[model samples]
Target chain A: MNTKILRNLAFTIFTCYVTIAVSETPHWSHDEQSTWWAIQDTTQNVPLNYPFGECGIGKHQSPVDLASATIIDSKSLNKLAALYDTDTAPVFFNSGHGIQVNTSEDYSGVLMIGEESFPLIQFHFHEPSEHVVGGKSFPAELHYVHINEDGRIIVLAVAVDIGEENPVFGTILDNIPHEEGGQNASSGIQINPAELLPADLDPANLDYYTVAGSLTTPPCSEGVQWYLLPKVITISAAQLVQLKDIYTNNARAPQNLNGRSLLSTQ
Target chain B: MLIKLFLAVSLSLSVASCFAESDGNKSKSLIDPSQQKRLSTDSSQQKQAAQPNASTKSTDSQSPQNSNQENKPSMIDFCRKNPC
Candidate 1:
């Protein structure tokens, strides 16, 4: 082969290899689908297109400290009605960030705030809780992400306090997929969403702090209404260890409130 | 012959563009957001704690909400006079 032809062929092959490698390797610091560390990458934190991927820039970002909030009368506050099913099995999957419980049509429920209610889409856990109270974090936090007919989002956050074994956590923790992107049907087991709520969690008596914030994860879209249940639900310490073992640091740092009002139903 | 030349030119252009984009991406650093902000501001401050004990048990029972008026009744006032 001619020396010139050989050199050209080598150049072409090298260029092709570089292209393939770059395309195959996920962007380390931006894609939340692959790793937890990238959420910490501030430059790429706000989506290149502002507001949508911009959790850092969004005024109503979530996981705020509830300690500094205004108190209101509880009598006028509406109760939280979680209509969960016991018959249908909920799908549990590991969404790289954390273990998520995907709700089925049969297992679907609605969380009524007042006349407006959001359909319970799915729930997931963040080890060591996301939102803090008095600057104190909990063992875990469960987020029931609800979307309404208008496509608005309202998240119901439950702080999990480690204590006696919780049946709901038992079912979920038992089926946690160790590998990233792994998912499993709960082995045809039916897990009640209501069971995940503390038995003594009376919404009327539950004084929750509300905030207008974006989703904690990527594509942190704004306008998410957060209803944080101060009532602590119990899951065994062993379960907490099992959860942390999967993703040691999946939670994002709480963003600045930017003067957003944090209301409470006391 | 003309068509073949056009195809070759297009292929080379696509490959060149791909290489250019990838090169641009490679130049960007993967610094943590907090660190990146501090660096840009030229401030010498300690890194924010990762809050490792975020999952530890706490006696503080404060739990946190939003203040949208239109969404207010739908969220907090719905189950008050109405059935759950």
Candidate 2:
């Protein structure tokens, strides 16, 4: 009888352990960004702590204010070469945080910096812009996230302003799922990410300001290479309304520069 | 026998919780020690190289270039329609 009781007790303990392990994945949101380091659950009157790292202590955080006085003209910096697939259909989703577009599994696109190439993983947007330029904030910003084989990250940021309607951007807005945690896949809509660039700019020799920073979100991992394109892309005021309706002020405020220098390929 | 089983279960839970905590720490330290040292070295070199241009401020709100006109890219009227 004692042996049978022991077996049942062991099984129950194992099940409880598995449940705890799965539930421990930290839940975070932009609602209380100041408390992102230690998110609290006050719904049950008991504090369920979900702590994050680096965000509270990292020296090289991202979304910094880019000013000309602090920027360095690095002639050694190479021009950005982005080789993106022009005909692949990408999946658009609203990930509660922002409107995100995930590249198809077979879609092969690359952002070349120097000799190293980082594969395009996914891209997302931030309202009212994240990185401020010369103390001026734009209507929105787009981040094209890439990752290399060595697990390094390089995020390319483009500032968006209110102007003429961008048909390609409009296609993304039309297909975006209105509700949070919603996704639109297999829409049979093909979007060439290159079209999102400035109409006059060349993809092979793009000019940008490079800096070392971290992820704006939780865990806020540092050592990410940031490439901020100085040129701005245009979207109509109505399109801005469509984006804001889905996510308004969904951007983390600019963090301290912490003595980081912006390197530009002028 | 009940006391022994209870102790074993408690020990297991402690170890599992430790593993979970360590996983979070691991993600925070994704860049290894060698890479961290290399990054610190590169940052020092960049700071030294950028010292010359750190003091020159320009009033041009449209561009990120300083008073050095040679470094400025040819001004393209890309945002003439919607001047921010």
Candidate 3:
């Protein structure tokens, strides 16, 4: 089992958390002077590449591998829409996905952050990403990022494990383009953001770790929100390999936990 | 400072290694079983799927740098030519 440490709203992560997407992003070009000329770009955040990984000391880190956690609230968090079906066009540029998501504008059944309807902009993926749970890791991690009119981020992370059939995942997995270049040309698999949430839905299991971490990849943006779910999900062997073969090691090891706290609604 | 950095680096290596090994098993599942299904789309994985050409944007386009992925690896090239 993933390291299920006593789930603690780590003080360092509280100040952060906010913040997923496509299977195989399209090709891109980078230039130093370009508008996207960011040293720690979103695609490659090559900080201190330690032999096994990088040593994140003063960095605001996430993905703390789950060890132990508690669910204060056991009540079911009402649902909006379980079946996420839409024609929303995802804008995957540079190294992230930017789609507008809101309570009114639905995708499967992902809830909106602020009251008013906001667009679920774009979501993206990160391997061994910054957010860690109870000090553990999953084969892969997914983030469903939604933003409000004011540009505030509400990210829902879904951990991926190996399994027989991921009912909710099949929707997204079945549609992900198996080939390259092909992914962008085609639309995403028909699904919603709700099915990917934990079965509990209780505010208790909803532990978070917020850190002032940068994008795991290049042009690593700073101040961006990083919401890491305490619970990790499962997928199939074939699916994991499919993901690995396409992107290889796409995750940018953890950063320094400059002392942040992980907040939860529960 | 050096000792702390060394410890941090060592912990990072172990963590990375642990992630790799744990991932290899692929049998254990997490509490949020539906997470896989719900994560149909998000910012990061979408970057892996197809990174848009930020240079060319319509009125509604966002900043490319704010999006996802460095570049698809060589393996994906085959799929691009053949497609699924």
Model 3, range B1-84, lDDT digits (tens) per residue?
999999999999999999998666543334343322121224442332111123442221211223333222221221122110
Model 3, range A1-266, lDDT digits (tens) per residue? 23334234443254343111122232323222122222232333354222112222223323333222222122222122212345354322223221111222233333332232324444444444434444455666776544433333334566666665567555444444444333442344343455555554443234443222334333333333444555556667876665554454455444444333332223
* CA displacement after TM-score superposition, residue A31 of candidate 2 (Å): 2.9
| Model 2 docking category | incorrect
Q: Estimated TM-score per prediction?
A: 0.61, 0.68, 0.46
Minimal lDDT window, size 10, model 2 chain A: A41-50
* CA shift of A170, model 1, Å: 1.1
* Ranking of all candidate structures by their TM-score, best first: 2, 1, 3
lDDT of 1 at A21: 54
Winning model by DockQ: 3
The reply for model 1, stretches above 4 Å from the true place, is A1-53, A73-75, A203-207, B1-84
* Candidate 2: tens digits of C-alpha lDDT, residues B1-84: 999999999999999999998654321111122322122234444443322122333121111112234311211110010010
Per-prediction backbone clash count: 13, 0, 119
Question: A-chain TM-score per prediction?
Answer: 0.78, 0.87, 0.55
lDDT string for model 1 (A15-40, tens) is 99777653332322223433332344
Candidate 2 global CA lDDT score = 0.66
Query: Model 1 over residues B1-84: C-alpha lDDT tens digits?
Result: 999999999999999999998754331111112321111211133222211112332112111222344654353222111111
Error of 3 at B48 (Å): 38
The DockQ of each candidate is 0.01, 0.01, 0.03
